[model samples]
Target: MAKRPEVVPDILDWYAESARDLPWRAADRTPWGVLVSEFMLQQTPVSRVLRPWSAWLERWPAPAALAAEPAGEAIRAWGRLGYPRRALRLHAAAVAITERHGGEVPDDHEALLALPGVGAYTAAAVASFAFGRRHVVLDTNVRRVLGRVIGATAYPPNHQTATERDLAEQLVPADPARAARWAAASMELGAIVCTARNPACGRCPVADRCAWLAAGRPDNAPPRRGQSYAGTDRQCRGALLAVLRDADEPVVGERLDLAWPAAVQRERALAGLLADGLVVRVGERYALP
Candidate 1:
């Protein structure tokens, strides 16, 4: 196994050479930009987020800009980002930031955590990447990297745990700036090389030190079940949302019914959407809130 001191520097060197040129990682990117990217990235691929992120930054620019608009505008601008509810939450977060933080994305980790949709991962990412603060920053990528390199596991637990959080905190460097860099580097390495499936161990910078590789990379965990979208309520919801997003006014109940053929599933989907506050009833019609 590689020396503890060498792991972070090796990952940082690898990241310096191979990191993707995402806009949010640019030298000039703002705290607001990082916040927006974090929200857009939840469960969405980087490739799919690129255009929407660019357009969103161009249109909104800052928290105050998005705060000025109606929640529906944010939903409409979300385009086809899948989880449209995030758009609503992001808009609400912007309003909170504007009202409470003087329109600036707060630099404090706790303050960032208090934002509407901001969670532990987002808060740590924004604090480290945007403000150059020392933090654990354990996103899926970071967690996967740590799992193989340090924990000798094929995969991390299905959910984050107190033990995982403590380990991550210990792995973070003492120097604030370097810890921030390590956060980004480790995450980048996991995303591109130490991937969940078909990990490119040959290309990994810390392959020599990887405990999982040293142990012959055993597959102790069962295969994760792939989620199906077709004919599911999620698919039904997406279809119903697409129609409302495209319409300039509240859509009639019958118009929404045309989005899905199965009466039971359609009603269930609409009910779920309404329950989730993604859609609202407007007299006899429905609209995005």
Candidate 2:
């Protein structure tokens, strides 16, 4: 068994003071709000999500309201958040909620996971934050923090195993309220202090207990590969979506043709978007459907 760090308490204590008071975390946040927040946070940064989340909650305060609207609105509402599929998936989730859960977010983890966009992280988050259940909320940030504080190296190649889950559960404070805060704190610590690149160890509350530091911070066996974004199909899709998101009406192929010049990449991008149901073609014009 790996030796656990002792400074988890200090980290959580520091997080209580430093964590951002996000709008989605307002005292009046309903289960619907929590669900929306988890969706918006996927692949999008906190600063980018703030204004949009506020606007979304203000416009559609419940799943029923969102379900009543066309899914295109959700995609347009997502703005430059990237990964527009999340918006479509969220719309489907709203519809499922209205049909299955009486327009209310499900409290049960299994029921939540059954939703279109909801997954393990989201289900556990909603369960803990909105429903006050004890569950290990593991995200990339949590995994990084746990890996450094205990293993003194990068995370393993695959997802967390049963043993890792048990260890995380053990570290969760027994008090439900505090445990929820602790989980969020661990995530925040990993995001801001114990980050993936050039971690701010000087500012970290758990530095003293970090096994990575104790082991002299040796470079791991190999460097992780970085993802390529430029000239990729994803970049072209985003460029195409940007135009659709801003257009008040459907745009013709000529207009979209102007966004990207490469014929092959442009056709591939358009086909991918069409296949993803992000855009619909009426005659020669394209628009969000």
Candidate 3:
């Protein structure tokens, strides 16, 4: 069995050579940049986030800048990111940062967690990656990597557990800098090599030390189900939002009616958008908010 400490150096060295040059990971990347990246990356792919992130940062470089904009502007700027509520929450977070944190993304994990959309994984990621603090930083990628390398599991649990948290804390290096690097490296390995499906074990740096590999990589019982997007209320909401996003003026109720054919579903979807604060009602029209 490979000792847990032995894994860090190999993973970090491989990361040094193979890590993707993501904009958020650049030396000059700001805490705000990291915060924005974290929010945008939620359930969205890196490839889709790149352009929108660039545009967003260019427009609102700081928390104060974004706070000055209306929530509608933030939603419009979100631009097909999906789950547009993240934009509203992010806008609220920026406003909170400007008012409470003096326009700075706080380095403290607790402070980061207090932000509107920031959660456990995001707070840890910002503290470790942006500030080089020692934190577990266990996102889906990191969880998957740790599950395979240490737990001998083909997949991590559907939700995080105390055991997983304790394991992550135990495995993370005590040295703050090394721990931060380990967080990024482990996540990168999972993202690019130890992927969810068809993992490239040959390219993994710690393949020899992986428990799952040693155990012959048995398939996960009760295979993970993929999310369905077609013809769902989510799709209806997206279509309605798309029309509003592209319009110059508040769209008529009749216009929104064209988005989804099923009257009940469309109404439910629109109501959901309104409830989510992603849309606003103006007289008989609706607009992004």
Candidate 4:
């Protein structure tokens, strides 16, 4: 508390020795690759994104390449990564990068933020990871690690606060490259060791410095619950989208009905997809958009 937390160096050392060999982190990885990985990684696990990301970059290695294609192609290629909207947004972002930034993922945080579908968190992530500029890259994993280590909270607030932002900013190293490394290191620590449930405390590099561990690791203020999937509208949506994704061409509305059992739920999900621009009505058939 008096000085920088003693755990910082330990976490960095662990990261250097233990980081996953992700394609996005490869020395040869392009800025476009990093941007694409970031977009695919939101809410979805790394395991699911690996094949898709590889094939995608292989197909469209640069912003200009993806921007040249129809947005619907991006959706079809997305292939059940859960939120297909991200694919559309990434396509839009690619278009912006191609037209406005001349086919380059801009290094400036503000410029990245200006791209379609790029939010504050994404802007900071792209700037720090891709460009190696100092910024507080607070993703969900980073927030959980910080909450436990510094605030002794089992979980962070549902919404990030001004106080949380100030703490995160103070924790970032002043040197751009060092700050970027720390940002990544802390996030990795959260994802692999300080997990949401059944954290491997014995494996954590900063177990000794963690305020939550020292405080007996009390329960969350409310409670933590795993997300539900069965019978949800999200499940219905995925089912409907999967049918469209696999089709070689636009299929009749009747063909889509075969994908899901509940007619009313299927119709609602279909309407929602149309609204989100993830699906399109072509004459009497539905198709990916």
Q: Which sections of candidate 3 miss by over 4 Å?
A: 1-3
Stretches off by above 4 angstroms in model 4 are: 1-4, 222-227
Residue range with the least summed lDDT across 10 consecutive positions in model 4: 1-10
TM-score for model 2? Answer: 0.92
Q: What RMSD, rounded to one decimal, does every model reach?
A: 1.8, 2.0, 1.5, 1.7
Cα error, candidate 3, residue 172 (Å): 0.8
Cα error, candidate 3, residue 177 (Å)? 1.3
True lDDT of residue 9, candidate 4: 84
Q: Give the C-alpha lDDT of model 1.
A: 0.90
Clashing pairs in 1: 2-209
TM-score of 4: 0.95
Maximum-TM-score candidate: 3
Candidate 1 lDDT, 89-201, residue by residue in tens: 99999999999999999999999999988899999999999999998899998888888888788888788988778877877899999999899998889888999899999
Backbone clashes for every candidate come to: 1, 0, 0, 0
Residues 1-289 of candidate 2: C-alpha lDDT, one tens digit per residue: 4757466679778987888787767788899888888999997788888888889989999999999999999999988887899999999999999999999899888999999988899999998888887778988888778877887885543557776676787788888888788778898898888887888999988788888888887667553565798999899999999999999999988888899989999999999999988999978799998
lDDT of each: 0.90, 0.86, 0.91, 0.89
lDDT of 3 by residue, 118-194 (tens): 89899999999899999988889988988888878889988899888888888899999999999999889989999
lDDT ranking from best to worst? 3, 1, 4, 2
